[model samples]
Target chain A: MLSQENRLSFFLSFASLLGVLLIWQFSTLPQASRSPYGIPDGNAEYQRLMGRSAVASTVRSDFPTPGAFARNAIEVLHAPFHNNGPNDRGIGWQLGASLLRVMIGYGLATLVAVPLGFVFGLQPVIQKALNPFVQILRPISPLAWMPIALYTIRDAELCAIFVIFICSLWPILLNTAFGVASIRREWLNVIRTLEVRWPQRLFFVLLPAAAPTILTGMRIGLGVAWLAIVAAEMLVGSSGIGYFVWNQWNNLSLSNVILAVLLIGLAGMALDAALAFVQRSVRYAE
Target chain B: MTLFPFSRRPYAFRAAPCDHGPALACQCGSTYPGIFTTGHENGLPTGAMSAQASVPAISRRHFLGAATGSAALAGLAGLFAPHAAMADTAPSGVVEKPDLNIGFVPISCSAPLIMATAKGFFQSEGLNVQLRKTAGWALIRDKLLDGSLDASHLLSPMPLALSLGLGGNAAQPIRVATMQNINGQAITLALKHWHKRDPRDWKGMTFAIPFQFSMHNLLLRNYLALHGLDPDKDVSLRVTAPPDMVANLKAGNIDGFLGPEPFNQRAVYEEAGFLHVLSADLWDGHPCCAFGTTASFAEKYPNTYRALQRAMIRAAYFMQEPSNRLEAAHIMAQAAYLNQPEIVIEQSLTGHYADGLGVVRDNPRRSGFSPYPYPSMAVWILSQFSRWGYLKENIPLQETAQRIFMIDEVRKQAAALALPAPEDGQNNWPVLTVMGQRFDAFHPPSYSKG
Candidate 1:
């Protein structure tokens, strides 16, 4: 289905990726030196312990080669959902845990933000009164909420969910308020002239008009929720993909960590894509 | 389920084993041994297990040979063998709670909690014990305080510090059920300072300890002070977790750290540091971690508490036999447990370790397990606490030990199980010795002249 230029671009991208892989493979070969200039630099004693030859001690270069990484990827990704007790689980299980937490927290945030936002949209005085607090809380890093959250909540799992809720809540609330407030004054006049019931006027006119903006806010919120879940899960440290990455780092297992990083990226992308589809569905033409 | 603590932070140093540009590498060619789930948990022992269950039959053969040669050993073998006395003494008709949760940091000192869970010692007394690894001693204390954990492997000094209101919780009154292990901690210095013999030469150096309320801090302070360096003024002490101790040492952020085992051994294996001195030698027979719980938990479930104490003591006894060390190491080195390299754990447990200076050192007390919570040991801890600024108020060492240690209950439980009871030091406490001077037994806790 691709055009000739599009096909050419795809081949060029594939070729560039191949080039990068080769460079990485050769530079990290067993003979590669740790020093930047491709030579081992250390005290005479260290050189003697690890011979004067430029070849690295297999233990010294913690990074596995590209072949090794691919091998690990295939082995691990092939059967991803193995549950290994509470602390150690497979990649699929961890990803599922993370996705579940993000959705629960994000869902709760939407429930509250939408209703409260409607109130603020209808009343200018209420929005003005809340603006200072909202602005201050919005810019604060979500992870900073961890210590206070843990202290007050006492449950680490709840603290993680609470943090995600706090972080995602602001965006949806602000955007929903903005969307509702900016609906054309003429639309409200039309509904009034037609004697449209309060519920009908709100649902049919206001919601349809605001759907695109609300979806945009949700898309933004989803991205932040995915990002914030990783950070929050890292601190709580019970289970989740974030804990898998942390535990691997503790073991000094870099390949497993790389696998986790890739999974987190893929998960974030998929979540954003889902929201993007919703945004597309709600788009309105002028 | 143990806590992994932090997943994404600067704690993750790009495994720059070489200048490989963060290119992911295999975690060695061997597949990581399976992490077990509940299905794997039933019937079959999965992953790295203490080959000890099979060991009892083999151990009996050796015990028979030894027993045939000696009369005293025959009696000892009968005592050492796993007994049904634990099941016989279940009090209160039924346990108020059979399913219990205990948290422990992943260290060799946590042998009691770990071995009990690993060997089905907890299951023997009808207790379904769930053991989880906590991030640190402070977190363990918090978990127990908040009732998230039923019991935890705690530092000997921690409950006392909490009871004394030194670390707050004025009348929270957590109890020490039994000691987890004894005489098993060491001071390790980064490779750069391995040659610096004198503590006097180490002024202005920063050292890491597991916690402020830990014996590592107290002992490090005592060791430095003995060499004429005021710990508070001369050298800075940072509270670092056991797992991060080696990494921080490699980064040279710490000059040295007096921390728990396997971590100290781990440093040497990684060639980041060398053993400076064993805490066992510094203060022989000091209590490290204890199987502890809130006094309220004990009051509410006496039978359950007794069952847990019996299980832990038996597990501690199992860990004491030299033959069990290798098996214990294997059990702890699993992904579901300590999740460490088995050889590193084996080295610490067996006391045959590479000291990071190319020579192998052997010392049987590198890490030891003893279940008895001696009152004198508690007194000694309180004395050290007073010596440092940790304890501000004047304390009656004897009365304090009696209150903090569950000595009367532990003695009854040990005796009922026919396990040897540590002599109660009720009337006369042991002489507080070492640190370049000896203080009489009856002196107040603030008597340390240093």
Candidate 2:
């Protein structure tokens, strides 16, 4: 059912993934024999305790192999909703908490950005006045704002949400403004001649014309939001995927950290894809 | 649907007492009413009270109702029963604030606080505690000052530093309720330096400490100075988070670190570093961490403060027993507390551990749990503050120590728990020997004279 081009691309993607996994598996394969470096002489107990003895092969490389990663991943994914207590929840719960925080922060950013972006697009003078401030604030890293946010907000949960809101705000605002300002003059003239009222002209005319561009901006905002939430959650350590990564790091379980990194990537990709689908749906023939 | 077939059971079912083991199952069915009946009684041991109070139970009617998609509702009722029962029985006006938020860093130093929560010491005392696991010491300090935390696990010198307004902190009066732990830190070095055991040979190496105000910094500086190497000029010391210390060592960013265990033991477990020296070797029976609260918090909630102090003291007494240490380690290693491997925590707590240099050392004094807040310990910490140039102004050291450390209050609480209190005179203010140098508590040497 697939075309030759599609089949070729799929095959290439699969082959590349296989190649990477194969390389990972080979590189992390334990050495057949390890040199007993610094193993004190005549202390068989010491050598055994240090995993240098021939009988006990407890010493492992710091990096997890593909097989180890797969085993850890299966263990983690097996019970994704088990809630042990406040500090230890399942991976599914962590991801859900992070996603919920992102959605709330992203929603608030959208609520603020779109209306202000409309005003900026409608008035060139207003846009020129605010442009410097927006440009200055946009380049500030989300982490830079964390301490200040924590200090001012005085609540860890709100501070994390505030960080996400700050990071995601600029992209959507700029994109919506740009999209609104770039709407064709001919359509505006047509609507003007028809004597459309302000509300209809704004919603029916302006909204549809700028829908794709606004969504493009929202797509970028969502991407930035997802990125910011992980860093935020890492700083505010109660519950989330970022906290899971940090807690596992505290335990020195590198495989669990790697698993979290993969989950974060997959979740981010899914978010972007969902927004892209919306963007496609709102596109016009013109 | 196949991904999570267990999802059909309410999420609370996972936390059901039955899921824990057979030991908890017997308590689940029989002991619910006994807790409520005994809730009004005073002077009962906290361990017994909590053992009875901790079992969340489903009533017979609720259990039958839970089968009809009401499991979560029933679970909520079961969870609220203990608090409701405690509130109803709490002699009306005694505990002003029954609900409390206590913050702690996820380290072995916070073992007593973690154990108190895990073993339901707070619940037995008619207090509902939410123990917030904070990220770092700075966040802990900030949260404490901002009133977000009722009390917290602090470094032994943190309350003093905050009280004196040292290290960019506002001069706020924070009181040390009880000393958390003693002699639980170590200087761990990367494996590359295993051969270079002597400190004099190491000139250009960088070391990491948990905080500038921490005892780790003072002891490390003292150790380096004893070796005739200036800590400031000969070596670079970086401030890093405790959790990141092992990763930083493994990445070769730091040559060594004088940090709190289980990080020191964790580094050895990961095979990234070897223990160069335990802090116990530097200063035997040194105070490391404290349990404290703001003076205002204690003033407003006096009864609650007393209850909290008693619970912590009892927990510390429980931890003092060598036989109880392994079980305590297992309890603290759960994901809600330290979130570490049981063996790593066991090695740190039980003091029987491999020293990463092909030696299995058994030293019971590795980490001690003493709840006493000695005034002399604060005096010694202030002396170090002066020694390290952290105290620019010459404040009254003995007066400040007396004011900050609630020695009498801790002694009273320990007495109430029927634990042995330190005797008068030499026992309370004994001379401390540090790295073969005598430090008299009565007459402190002037570090300002160099």
Span of 10 residues, lowest total lDDT, candidate 2 chain B: B54-63
Q: Candidate 1, residues A169-233: lDDT per residue as tens digits?
A: 99899988999999899988899999999899879988888888877778788888889888887
Q: How well is candidate 2 docked (DockQ)?
A: 0.29
lDDT of 2 at B62: 11
Off by over 4 Å in 2: A32-37, A41-54, B1-93, B423-428, B448-450
- What DockQ does every candidate get? 0.14, 0.29
The CA lDDT of each predicted structure is 0.70, 0.76
lDDT per residue for candidate 1 within B1-450, as digits (tens), equals 011112111211111112111221221122111111001111111111111112111111211212122223224434453234334443324777999888878788887788898888788767998787666676677678878899999988998988877865555788899888766788898887755757888899999999988888888887788678889889999998776788899888999999998788778766678777776555545678888898899889988898888788777767766678889989988876787788888877866666565545566555667676656667778887878877877767767776778555664454444443232222224454444245443554354544
Q: What TM-score would every model get versus the actual structure?
A: 0.82, 0.85
| Model 2, backbone clash pairs (residues 3+ apart or across chains), number | 0
Error of 2 at B78 (Å): 42
Candidate of highest TM-score: 2
